[model samples]
Target: MASSQRSRSSTLFCAFLTLLNDRLSESLIFPLLPFLLASFSNDGRIIGLLAGSYALAQFGFTPLIGALSDHYGRKPVIAGCVAGSVLGLGLFALTLSIDWASVAWVSGSSLPLGLLFLGRLIDGVSGGTAATASAVLADITPPERRAKAFGLIGVAFGLGFILGPAMGGLLGRINVMLPLLIAVAIAVLNLLLVVGVLPETHPPQARLPLPRKRDLQPFSPLARVLRDPRVRRLCSAFFLFFLGFSGFTAVLVLYFKQAFDWGPGLAGAAFLVVGVVATVVQGGLIGPLVKRLGEWRLSLAGLGFVIAGCLLIAVAAPATAKVLVFSGVALLALGTGLVTPCLRALVSRRLNDAGQGAALGSLQGLQSLAGFIGPPLAGLVYETISWKSPFWLGITLMAGVVLLVAGGLPGQAGPRAEVT
Candidate 1:
């Protein structure tokens, strides 16, 4: 039994490393994207479209991937997704190379834009790795320890946010395509780690069969999840929360450029501050807080932090206060760090082992839907109204979400071992 426990611990550690690498690969592009697109057209609308395209593809495919993970297994699905990301990153870098080699060709035609979109679309379609990773955690962890387990994933994200954008920004200063190539390399490394070190957590007896034609409908998993009132309420809250957060993130790099005359490195540095704060909150604070406040209350507190952060950021842009901007981002990160793992723990606690993958997948799908809409809307508002408009909009939507969660969610203390 001691040896078995040691093996499980080792596997979980490997899983954590895999998740960290996966997140790094995903986030490496964000800080560089605004600069990359600006070289093409300097159009915020186009930037928004390119950013949203990834989420649009993710929105369609996340639930499908989640259901597939349930039917097949986590290890294979995760490995496949990482492999896909490697291909997508390679394509993205190739397009950039082509555009640089023949600037006139890029200027004369839409081929570069098409290639960019296609690359992002490919990555987005396989973006279910996070949800699948969560399912693996659920499979391995007991209910009572799940919150802390999820918090560990948040730590991985925090570390990724710190490293990915900062590295991307620093490398982008050298050459824009450097980050893309690096991300591709990281994806390849992640794929190798997943295949070599990660074991299949979901036993064959526990796995679901492949979906039927009707069950495979794009909206079918969503509809099925919505049938449960509790899950539906959580999903609604998740959607609203991300709707605001995603929009803010979508325009953040552009906002930095316009407001402070910053470049990718400065934007990345700001994100690094956020990541540092988030790492502290999610890594150090969540477990004890969940023990005291419960997931629902912690989520409420997180919303409150987010509201303040958004307002501060909106004010900072107009005032050009560097301190206020960083402070606000730190707060935003803190809130998100707390909210994410707690919400996942709450949702996981509400479901049995049988439904973990599907339920979490649906939750992630809602987030992707928010991502799909938020970036485009933010870009439009930024282009037409002001640089600060998206942040203000985020504040308003988050306020509404506060009310939604307060009214709709039940008082669940935390996960219990025998929830089912």
Candidate 2:
């Protein structure tokens, strides 16, 4: 029994590091995008394209990665993806090392920019790190404990998001390539860890290989999974929840900059507060909260907090109240911390072991989809309406998400909750 527990602990630690490495790759590069692109083109539109490409690639590839993990095994897929991440980051760093404009033969900013897109695409496709890590957690943990377990992902996510930019901002001062180099080193470490230390949680007895090549098609797998009525409803709430959350965050920095005249230093600091609150809540508080409130009630309660937080931010924009902005963002962080893990737990609790990777992969896919669409749509409204428009839009969308989660969930909760 002691050995079993130790193994689980070891697996969880490895999974945590894997997820942290995945998240840091993106977040570490996020703030540096403008600086990285400034040499080629300072067009604001180019930044959006560069940023959006990552989500687009993740949307298309993560489900495939998840299914592959189910078939081949978690360790290999994770290692390969992490290797891909290292390659991606290394390529980006290499591009930054050379001055693209001086090389005459490199026509129309094709080489550097093309490689940048390729790198993000590779990393984004490799974004299955979180989905597969969740699968490994499911493989080991009991259902009752899974929600609390998923809090590890949130903690890793918060830490990576906060620490990445902090490191980027500081390292970028010495050299632009420093953070990318750091990310490369981290990815290499993850690859080595997965290859050497992480055990195969999904043994041969548990493996489910897809019979046909078409089974690997990302959307088809998604369609097949969501065909389950109960899973479909839960997934809807998940999608809507993220749609609003991503929508607001997509425009958040713009709101901070245009509305409040804040620089990246102040804006990044604001995110730091958000990360701290999220880490504390998801890390320290979720286990007990999930135990007492249960996943259902906890998810709804978290949604309530998110709604209130969005309202505060919307109000803050017009009032120019720095205190309110900080307060609102902190609330957003807290609510997100609660909602993310709980909702994930709820979906996880519904699915059996065999489908964990596929379903969770689908969840990750929806998240990437929401991320891809939310920004452009929110940006459009922000352009047409006002700086505060994304918040208002988010608040409206989030209200609907709350209803979906609250109303739809109870009916779908089967007497014993079996696969349909």
Candidate 3:
């Protein structure tokens, strides 16, 4: 019995490490984006297009990969994705090498953009890790300890964010490609670890077939999913929440630069506070808070914090006051951390079947819609009127979310977990 427990613990530990590795490699690209943009033609629209394309690709692919995981089992899907990510990162790092060896001094600034989009698309298509990992956690953990299992996964992600961006920023200062190379190495290491150490979570006997992979229109599944009232409500609330949150995040660096004339390192540090706050709140406080207040109340608390954070941003003066700006971000993180798990749990419980991969994939597809719309909207807001416009809009959205939740918006109807 003791040996069995030890093996389970070891498996969880390795899974956590793999999750961290994936997150770190994925985020390394963000800090280098502006640098890459500078090297290219300094077109804001083009940059926005590139960012949106990454989001669109993720939106388009995560669900498909996730659904596929249900039929094929988790280990194979996750390993393949990690291996593919390593290849993608290698191509990203080698972008400049192609031009470097040429006799002609032709600029190769477009390579990063192309590689980034393609890499993100592949990663999106390959992101069965979360679905598989979540299923693995469910399989290993007793029902009473499930929240703890998910919370630990959140901790892994938070810890990765805490370190990933800072490292990416520091590495960016050395050379833009350096961070990409590090990401590639980490991915390679992650693949090896998974292949050598990880055991199969979903054995052949436990496997089930997934829905047929129809090449449907982008918004079709989203619309179909949203047609269910419960999913509609959750997605509506989530969309509003992310619309606000992503908008603010998209413009945060610009706000710092414009309002305080700060540098990239400091901007990176500000976001670091966000990751820390998110980690602490989600990992340490969420379980207790959810147990005490239940999902609805906890979600309200999160929405309230988001509103407050948006208001702070709207009124922010001299954004370079690192402490103050970071304080707002911390609040944002705190609120988001409180709410996300509840939102996700609601979904998880709703769909309480062996088909976690499909459900989560659908959820991710919904989540990615924010990525497509939020950043470009924020950029437009910043360009048209003021950098603070997005914050004001976020505040308004959060206010609506709060009011809706407070009004018993979801209502005590069908199982809250089904459509999540």
RMSD of each: 4.5, 4.8, 4.3
Q: For candidate 1, lDDT tens digit of each residue in 220-324?
A: 667777777667777777888898898878888888887778877777778878778887887778878888778877888899999888888888744566788
lDDT tens digits by residue: candidate 2, 171-232: 76677677788999998888888888789988898998765767665677567667876577
Instruction: Return whichever of 2 and 3 wins on lDDT.
Output: 2
> Which residue pairs show collisions in model 2?
none
TM-score for every candidate vs. truth? 0.84, 0.78, 0.82
Worst 10 residues of 2 by lDDT: 411-420
Whichever of 1 and 3 has more lDDT, that candidate is 1
Per-residue alpha-carbon lDDT of model 3 for 1-420, expressed as tens digits? Answer: 998887788779767877887677756666455554454433334444555655776677766666666668777777887887776667656653344335344444455557656765666556556666777788778899998788767777888878877887677667767777787788888888778777777777876777655743357666766676644676677777777677667666666666777665666676677778888887678878877777777787888887787777667676336566777877888999988777767655555576454555566676788877777777777777776787887888888767655555354543342222
Alpha carbon lDDT at 320, candidate 3: 32
In candidate 1, what residue range of length 10 has the lowest lDDT sum?
Answer: 411-420
Better of 1 and 2 by lDDT: 1
- Candidate 3: count the clashes: 5
Clashing pairs in 3: 347-420, 349-417, 350-417, 350-418, 351-417
Model 2 RMSD vs true structure = 4.8
